[model samples]
Target: METEKQYVIRCGNGYVRFNLDGSMIGCKYKSSKTTESHMKRLPFNIDLAVASGIIKIEEAE
Candidate 1:
């Protein structure tokens, strides 16, 4: 079976996961200084993230 491809971006002290269609899957943070509220304030769309020019996209597996 074929599996769907997903992308990830490193945002601040965490990482954001999304699909090719620009839909956000979720976000995870490794630092205790980060929180969900902080992430929500950031862009969630792929285009926005790219336009911001602060995030790097990578294929998930």
Candidate 2:
């Protein structure tokens, strides 16, 4: 079976993963200062991330 396309964005203390449809898959934070609440405050949308230079659209292998 073919695998679904995915994307990723490396943030300050972690990374955010996304599906090809621009929906968020999940996020991971490495620092104690970073939390789900903080991540929630940031834009996770693919288009918004691109517009803000937060990430590029590249298929993850």
TM-score of each: 0.38, 0.33
Off by over 4 Å in 1: 17-45
Tens digits of lDDT, candidate 2, 1-61:
9644444456544666544444554466422222333334554544676678775443444
Sliding window of 10 residues with minimal summed lDDT for model 1: 30-39
1-61: candidate 1 lDDT, tens digit per residue: 9544544567665676544344554466422232333335554554565678766655544
Cα lDDT, all candidates? 0.51, 0.48
lDDT of 2: 0.48
Model 2 residue 18 CA deviation (Å) reads 6.8
TM-score of 2: 0.33
